[model samples]
Target: MTSVSSKKCNKEEYSFVYGDEAVSYEVVRKPAVEGLSHQKSQRKIAIKVHPSCEVVVIAPEDTEREDIHKAMMKRAKWIYDALKEFRGHLEHVQPKQYVSGEMQFYLGRRYVLKVVEDADALPSVKMTRGKLLVTLTRFNDGKTSMVRTLVSRWYKARAERIFHERLSELVPHATWVEGIPSFRVLPMTKQWGSCSAKGSLMLNPHLIKAPKECIDYVILHELCHIAEHNHSEKFWRLLTSVMPNWKEVKSRLDGLAELYLNE
Candidate 1:
């Protein structure tokens, strides 16, 4: 007969004061390697501060509680700075008013909204010259929701067409990846895009507002997940193989979030 013992894992949450702010974070312990002694296995802790300002700490199964605390304290300044910057960006985000001369973002460029009323013309939205030309059959007071809905539909249509085109252009470069995954454009509150274990990708419609390169970076990032699911070392190496300047592009996308996501 063979005897076996199972290892137990659990997650704990802790709060700490940083720069006069109470910051809470979660600590998780999970097995990282198999057939290795606990002392010999990788024990380094990993910390991530998400765009939504959520902090998570992942550590080896046998890591000490005090060590996690020490690590958090060491990185306190970096965490504080990131939170401050994110808050500053949030402060500037305001809902769209859909009025003429109001700024709208498209392909990393700013365009002024120009609402035109043409009873005979079809209700449509397009870029004429440099401005976003929104033509409607009639304009009345308290019709902002109608205008917003029409513009939203137009953006979604463009996102569907352009995202597919870009995916077709970039997928060939990833030789190791096989089969084109279906994608959908929708609004997401916390993430720009995500690839599910199933062969489908969900992209934020707001992404259509970003630069072409930034959009490419995001698509490639999700595609790489088909090859490597987790954000492990292998996943990043795969992403870099395709887009070496992904970090710079990612930064630009994050900065532009304030403009597009607020709407």
Candidate 2:
């Protein structure tokens, strides 16, 4: 089996493999899905796994190959369990049944989606008094994915606006990072956001449901990646310099993940 090493990856930019178990753990800044990276102790490596994708491992440049492998082996059980849960989640994550008065979450608030059909009206979503009103021209018999897609798209659009506003507050000096190209909302099993060395950032729509501080923390985190591609000491030092209370926000966000990730 190939051993994990401290050698810098030229193509991957940043990666780590824990244990000599032959599992290749590589980290790549990818499109937004639904999960966050978890790291403990001294933060030598961070693991971000999407319910639908492979595990990405990030570590400092000086981490030894064998040590990284050992750490990964220690985490093997947890990784296996997480993937199992992800598979179960995929089998059951059918879109919210578009029944009348179905409960749903939007912007951290509870709202009931009341679906109505009007041939003369284009599909529209609006806050009618206090309820969310969805007017569709036709209900394609039991094609729930369409309704769910519509709702998800609506949420993503709203999230973009809210995310931009919040991110602006956190990284006022931040500029439009280029080359990293494209950001979109997708059903992610395990992360809040991602950033590419090329400069693009992918964010989760679930941020709309999280606390403002948590949202800011995620934004700051991905932005920090623009400067330091790995979870090296220098990268964290930079994060601390910018968001001193990041640890608090991180804890809160981690709790939030447990709460909403089941959906």
Considering summed lDDT, which 10 consecutive residues are worst modelled in model 2?
13-22
Task: Give the per-residue lDDT digits (tens) of candidate 1, residues 128-175.
Answer: 888998988888984677678888998899899889999999999877
lDDT by residue for model 2 (1-263), tens: 23443336454422333343334456433333235333332245666555563667766554555555665666776766665666664665454576667655665566777888889999877766557777788888754665666777777788888887776566654443333335556557799899876767788887776777787788888888988899999889888878889987886566446445543
Residue 218 alpha-carbon offset, candidate 1, angstroms: 0.7
The lDDT of model 2 is 0.65
Best by lDDT: 1
Q: After superposition, how far is residue 94 of candidate 1 from its true place, in Å?
A: 1.3
Pairs that clash in candidate 1: none
Cα miss at 204, model 1 (Å)?
1.0
